[model samples]
Target: MAKKVVATLKKEGGSAMFTKVVKMTKSGGNGSYAFEERIVSKDSAKDFFSK
Candidate 1:
């Protein structure tokens, strides 16, 4: 089974950056999921970054 990350981004209150989370799938095992400085968005990149 392969494991993947599920994350989201939200406006950092008054910051000019975004908040995110890195989650692993139930079947993603553990070492299967690896990411760094990655961005996850529910909308388009432009829309996500625009906010």
Candidate 2:
């Protein structure tokens, strides 16, 4: 189940190693902005947002 994946990560301290990065991007051909979510390693969290 979905809980299993999350449970293991917590047990091994993997949750802290990962981060959620949300980015707002302009829609193609539209003047609207939307949010994008990504699960990235903590080390690259800044890079994801910088781009």
Candidate 3:
């Protein structure tokens, strides 16, 4: 699954169309940070990390 995603993102124009976003978030119960990931449109990448 990871390989497929990486291959697809390498295609011409593919990167501009999509992106993989990862955000670090704190756990309310443990005070530990967890990583959150999502495949989102490139245009919305900033919005995804802002939250």
Candidate number with greatest TM-score = 2
Candidate 3 local lDDT, residue 2: 95
Tens-digit lDDT track for model 3 on 1-51? 999977888799887798778898899998999999999998899999787
User: What C-alpha lDDT, on a 0 to 100 scale, does residue 34 get in candidate 3?
Assistant: 95
TM-score, one value per model: 0.21, 0.80, 0.61
Which parts of model 3 are misplaced by more than 4 Å?
1-12
lDDT, model 3, position 51: 72
Query: What C-alpha RMSD separates each model from the true structure?
Result: 13.2, 1.4, 2.7
TM-score of 1: 0.21
Clashing pairs in 1: 2-28, 3-28
* lDDT per residue (tens digit) for residues 1-51 in model 2: 989988988976799899899999998887899999999999999999889
Query: Model 3: what TM-score?
Result: 0.61
lDDT of each: 0.39, 0.92, 0.87
* Full ranking by lDDT: 2, 3, 1
TM-score sort, best first: 2, 3, 1
